[model samples]
Target: MTTTGTIRSATGYLRSWVEAQAAHRRVPGVQVAIRSGDELVLSAAVGVADATTGAPLSTGHLFRIASHSKTFTATAVLRLVEAGHMRLDDPIGQFVPELEDGGSPIARVTVRELLGHQSGVIRDGQDGDFWQLGRPFPDRSGVVAEVLRAGAVHRRNEHFKYSNVGYALLGLAIESVTGSTYAEHLQASVLEPLGLTRTGAEYDPARAEEYAAGHTGLLLGEDTRQTIEHVDTRAMAAATGFWSTAEDLTAYGAAHYLGDERLLSDDSKRIMQRLESIVTAYGTEVGRYGVGMALQTVGERQLVGHSGGYPGHITLTLIDPVDRLVVSVLTNAMDGPAEDLAVGLVKVIDVALTPRTEVPPPPAGAPPLASFTGRFASLWGVLDVAELGGRLVLIRPTLTDPLPGVEELEVVDASTLRVAAQPSFGPAGELVPVQRDADGRVVSLRFGGVTSRPVDEFRRLRSGMTHLA
Candidate 1:
């Protein structure tokens, strides 16, 4: 998504690069969606949704969004609090009486502890092999039985301990208070209110054709994929049993922002997204967690959402509350780079929206410089020649942090330029000449005694390099 232009044009460029990245990574399939407030700015999918059947992916296809289910569960809990049905500080024993009867330490943990992962509740059950499909996920009876056998791992509010079982207990609490199943309560109270028609609390066999098949590689160097079987999570579904599409997920994410009356009130949203605890598992770069959503700090933006890791599917939904921007990425492969893809897509949109500082120095700009701006490639990799601050610079677009190699392009006549700003690239005034085509358009560029071929319609963006020369 390198080429700078209008958001629509930039999104068009992003779609092609995303498809190409998915192909290069050998991901079976992927779907991505970007939103500006409530409007869907970009929604695209590529590759096969089902590797065995080779069905192409669609933007509407469902993905098992794993732990993203926690966010919905959290939302449902907050709605109950809004209705004055229950308070965050309510003790679990008040609702799920089984806890007190079973003599579990979890009984002492407050509802707020469970919501913020401060309950120190066991993540899954004893022998949580259900994650690998070796055993079925626990039912309500099984959950209660586990609570009886094993309780909280640490004192309440001791640390940030992520617990799937904690959410299951919250589900039980919701059911006990509302006199309805967690799924039914969530549907009537949360999903429908947010207009998330494509989202489901549990896997629906009737919609099997629309669901993406999940594939996992059990061991290292295992390029071949093994399809993960679909099963009901039952009680634990509140923690990991949700399915959704990227477009729908982003729309749902947008509802959590302020000014969106479709879901939580601004006060409730603040309660949900308030950075309750910082996760030690993740460094400060990812920030902390608030209620069910994971808060990440990217630049000055506070991106909040949740990530889901199912056996065969990996998904992510991040929303920039300050910008009212949301990005969601879903993949069917277990090793799919959904987080990276989502972050990269967000960067692309942010760059496209911001005004470019480099506008080509004065005059109407040299005609030949237009040819110099296309991406040049070679056996080593790609060399991105673009105008930055009215000066041309070569950059490598593939690196996660790509500023060290930036070498400014100083115009020397129209066909030749000098690589400035770095001595390791060659001498400061190293001469680089551009080759032309029969149409009198610049084609290939020669640098460091090597002639590099330019790729047609290729764009390399380096706005992150603005701090450098």
Candidate 2:
């Protein structure tokens, strides 16, 4: 539906925006690809794969996709569901014997809840030692043991709280059902059939030079320092540990948009795209937990996508099934503005998806200043707002201590304000846009996949509040 001229303009703008943002953030490498229907619309790379080695990134350069790998894991499970090997409502105890008598009634945890992130299991591998140091990640038994020891966060099917541990258990279920490892099952069922040569769960040591090195910005505290940490997370193999490229990601997105015999049926794909949860009170957007994919509406149109963040990488892949358009973005730096870039790319594609007619250019300046101060909560985290010196200050309840200081807010409209916080020892500032309802009430705020809105009572509050003003 997008006109040729508008599509060209959008592609050019996306390339320019991504390049500039990557450079400003000191992100060494990035790969982006856009697809419409089964046709590849655009595929490009920017910056260097290795900042130290000076290798220019290409569409072939693989980066750790982190939790985006969850899609693959979920796909493998769905394959079993389709083959009658397992049921979506099957209990975890049916597969893993260790979890059967764990004394926590693990049998009550269904496979669907695990995939939907409603199993109420504790989030795995978040301890300080897991990320900071090269701590050995737990295996299938180890992760299950940890969950049993820690216990569930809430009753089963109570609410939507993301749990890596739940997916990890699903991975175990995959192995038990297929009589093979999670990696092997995925390769056979999803990757190989899809012709994704550059995607896999295991990181090949021989191809280490081919993979992009992950980087992190310097810590901004009493001392300012830069650090490059390599993510060696084999323990998260089934949860958040897969490496992929833009080319492979685009192909996968296309398969989802265009169903294949080796993968899901059209009916199954439609079921996957249905919203399982109404994340907001307005119900304008529904987060449907299909087999392994999340379906949500952007405006009146439905979009299917997922985002992932690790210590050294941030990745987002979104597909608009209506127009059969897919946008995939990957960055080497963890804290980079990958989410914003993804959103911007999607907007460009949407503009291109239909004819564009402009009568006149709007005013060049921003809207009048308006303070965005309120409390927003969701399943993941909470955002508390305060007005200071004509600016909006926000603090995350999980982090202790007030924000460094007040930050400037740019009013986008009467109901939206974009808050810009100073770079955390990087060249790029953290940009968060907060949206309010017509009543001037904070309805929702999004920073990556972490969205907090009213009516979400399962809030994880931390004693130490860190202000990023």
Candidate 3:
């Protein structure tokens, strides 16, 4: 740990660093909030809400939070569960009868599976053009028909595959069980009760002037002169369509971490955060997926959180359950730079949250003689390294263009090297850690959940890299 002065300086540095990254990455707007214990440690806004209009973004500016809306949906389901209206193990088909019409039996999919993203439902929301571009958005029945027509990608409970359709179905289940529309039920059950007046799924055209204009990143191999097209996604109302502010998300995160009896029982909250499945890397448990959150360990501390991305928006929310600290970053544009900025901000917040203690000096010796240096490749791309100034310098060529060449790599330990480059960083710096073997050869790598490696290559690389650098 370090002193308060060190923490404050780190926080200030992070704030400026993230702002600079956001500007360079062409991110139109961003808002970040950090909560430690019950106190709001930091909440600030940077960049513009609408780049075309040059409107300054503020903490109060609303942005469509995209899949982050799933947390709200899950909360609504939990509220119903609290009231004994439904059980986690209840078959979703029992509530939404239409879901069972396909040859696939709905009884096989449970409420828990949907919430945990194990229902094997194909993610039909990817075909957003059909709904976003003037075509009518499907209601519950229409979405069900799409799923049946598309068919399941895998059997129910087969593995952890994220499905926006699964969540949409869960929303419909809430409606069926409560006899209310998804929005209405959510408003009555979660938002109204929590006094979150700013949160909702409705896209009010009248308020469009106040809403931030969504901006997409210019596609690669396309005309860079033409800005990525922006469109109002009213059709994604249930899957990726909910507007909120950092202030509202802070309140939501606090409710979850601090145990709000009004919304859910402490027991249920525990269940929500509990790890339901052990996700593997080379057949070893590296991470776990809970009801609607990801469970990961940073050193000895376990973090619970989730990340959301839409066409023109990206958001990340993470919680340090031990310290009751929450860090959230929201951006209005989907440009490549947003994720890196968000992840850097999370590290700064984490440093601020950590208590002052004796600082450990930088690793002794000339960077361990570069015992691990070589070429490593995965589906993610490639990592090439060489000994530089007695330390290993890793080169990640997968970074999106517009970034400087050969970014510096941070050594998590002796064996793991994480590239804190653009398009990969999150509020928690989640997309780093290019893992290597004891012999300093790359064995496996982790970016978010998906891990990649060479077949039967682990044995040859077993002693390649040492413990994280």
The number of the candidate with the highest TM-score is 1
Candidate 2 residue-wise lDDT at 244: 90
lDDT of 1 by residue, 183-275 (tens): 899899988987889999999899988888898843576667767777788999889999999999988998987788677888888887888
lDDT of 3 by residue, 318-426 (tens): 7766557677788776653544554455543443444222222235442452444544455444544534332333434233321233333455565454544445343
Model with the higher TM-score, candidate 1 or 3: 1
Residue 112 shift from truth in candidate 3, angstroms: 0.5
Best first by lDDT, ranked: 1, 2, 3
Q: Which regions of candidate 1 deviate over 4 angstroms?
A: 1-6, 281-287, 354-376, 383-397, 400-436, 439-443, 446-451, 454-469
| Evaluation by lDDT, superior candidate among 2 and 3 | 2
Error of 2 at 125 (Å): 5.2
C-alpha root-mean-square deviation, each candidate:
6.1, 14.4, 13.4
Candidate 2 C-alpha lDDT tens digits along 360-407: 221256333333555566645455554322234344423222223223
Worst 10 residues of 1 by lDDT: 457-466
Q: Identify the runs in model 3 with alpha carbons over 4 angstroms from their true place.
A: 1-11, 125-136, 221-238, 278-288, 336-339, 353-469
